[model samples]
Target: MQVMDPLTSPKIGGNHLFCYALLFILIASHVSLSASARELKVEPKGSVKDLVQSSKATKIKRTVNGLLEVVLVDAKGLKDTERFSGGMDPYVMIKYKTQERNSPVAKGAGSKPVWNKRFSFRVQYPDYAGGNGYKLILKLMDKDSFTADDFIGETVIYVEDLLVLGAEKGKYQMLPTKYRVVGSNKKYNGEIRVGLSFTPIR
Candidate 1:
């Protein structure tokens, strides 16, 4: 058996060194190219500002005109006020943006009243929704002949959530299922069913 010493095998050593040198060149070239590619992608802070301005411009195009339709489906578990003897007369008040709509006084339905009424409000962007979101407010009240209507329960819903879910104008986007009513100190009293949708202005 003959063992060939690596030091004595110049041809073999040369081949091995050549292979390693080729591998090193390939690796170095790859790294250099990658670094140059990265350097070509220079994203400046002004690019960020440009992107923000582009976003604002697109939003302005969407700000043509829209109508937010809030439908007061029904409400349950309302506070039965001792301020009255019989079943309390209940109605729902809806406030969205700077617009408000009061449902017809459901004469004497008391707790668990049903309105199934729909209200619409005009929205010109940057006015109703210039910032983050527009909030939908629903308040249950008791109508009285002599005194002002009594507040039963209230809940607030944000249109931003639905809008972010890819709600386009002229399309109806129903709100979640129902909202629990919370009072002055965030007291839970009842749950109300409502639907929300946006439509392009005519």
Candidate 2:
């Protein structure tokens, strides 16, 4: 067995020590950078389509006894600012209390949008909100790209007038009644054409 001298055997010179220190620093820096990278996260923003789908999910819990049926015939004379490439796309959001329904997109309809879409909202008489002078609010909106839908105009029909007008005519069809769509600064933007047929369910 041969033994080497402690003092003369491969002494760590200043150059080797400096190289070791540099290697240690490099390794530590790489580890630190890796840890920092692992902690970072990026969240994504929700799209407009997502919002539309979510809105569809929120529905009303209908009551059984003495329900009222409101029919949505069609809409006309809606003026919307052009947003999309070709033309404006519009849709209707029909809301009453906890009940809500969305009309199909009026593709390339521009100002004159017609959705002959029908939606039924159930309400118990006496306990019903429509009988209490609450009007049916229709918000004509333009669907945009990144943001929420833009409001084109709005029209509200008195619920009391709906049933009474039908009783007076002796039929459900309340004629082609034109509700003036009011806009910003109380200006008349356009008229929305809608019909009401009240059916009292047993």
Candidate 3:
């Protein structure tokens, strides 16, 4: 003997169908509009002052030292913003680069000195690497809001040859260099400007 429930069967079937239809429409709309929005634009503006060496090095030197500075600015041209978090704590990194076209990922065993926004930071270069033409990348961020909001600037310094790695016995001359200011933010939406310094020691 078979018993059929007429009322409950139709109601349950209708509910399931309604739920499935609603889910399908939502998913379809999400797929269509996912790629139709405009991306944000962030720009940094600044300038790098100059590179100054403590005492000139001799030929084939193992260590080199110098000073770097950058003038901070804003989008409105020299207008100070709350973005700087009051002052900048600067940092400098010297990377042993393989070629002139290599990037930060190709760098190794770097040094970051304490930052000072007087547009001046002290930098130190290592003596050994596996290749010629080492690159110097300089960066700056907020001393207080380093993890929150701040500014960052970078410039490259190129050394001549790997042979100069040990040029400690001759006149160690450092050339002049400069960088242009630029800015970026991953959490907020805005534009930035500052004088950037990009001086590569070649």
Q: Give the per-residue Cα lDDT of candidate 3 at 57.
A: 38
lDDT per residue as tens, model 1, 1-202: 9786554665677878677779989999999999999889666665434644554555644444667778888888887874437888888888876677999887888888888888888765445443436787888888878877778888888765344322332454775368999866678888988888776565
Report the alpha-carbon TM-score of model 2 versus the true structure.
Answer: 0.57
TM-score of each: 0.63, 0.57, 0.29
Q: Which candidate achieves the best TM-score against the true structure?
A: 1
Count of residue pairs whose backbone atoms collide, per candidate? 0, 0, 38
For model 3, residues 48-140, the per-residue Cα lDDT tens digits are 211122123333244555433333332212112334344333333323343112112211111222222224333345535555434544333
Relative to the unseen true structure, what is the C-alpha lDDT of residue 84 in candidate 2, on a scale of 0 to 100?
A: 40
Give candidates' CA RMSD values in order.
Answer: 7.6, 19.5, 22.0
lDDT of 2 at 193: 76
147 Cα displacement, candidate 2 (Å)? 2.3
What lDDT score is found at residue 88 in candidate 3?
32
TM-score of 3: 0.29
Candidate 2: tens digits of C-alpha lDDT, residues 1-202: 8786443558767687677779989999999999999999976775534433443344223432333354555556666677446567888787766677788888878877777766777654224553434467788788888877777887777664344332333334455577888876578888877766655554
List the global CA lDDT of all models: 0.72, 0.64, 0.36
Model 2 worst lDDT window (10 residues): 59-68
Candidate 2 whole-model C-alpha lDDT, 0 to 1: 0.64
RMSD of 3: 22.0
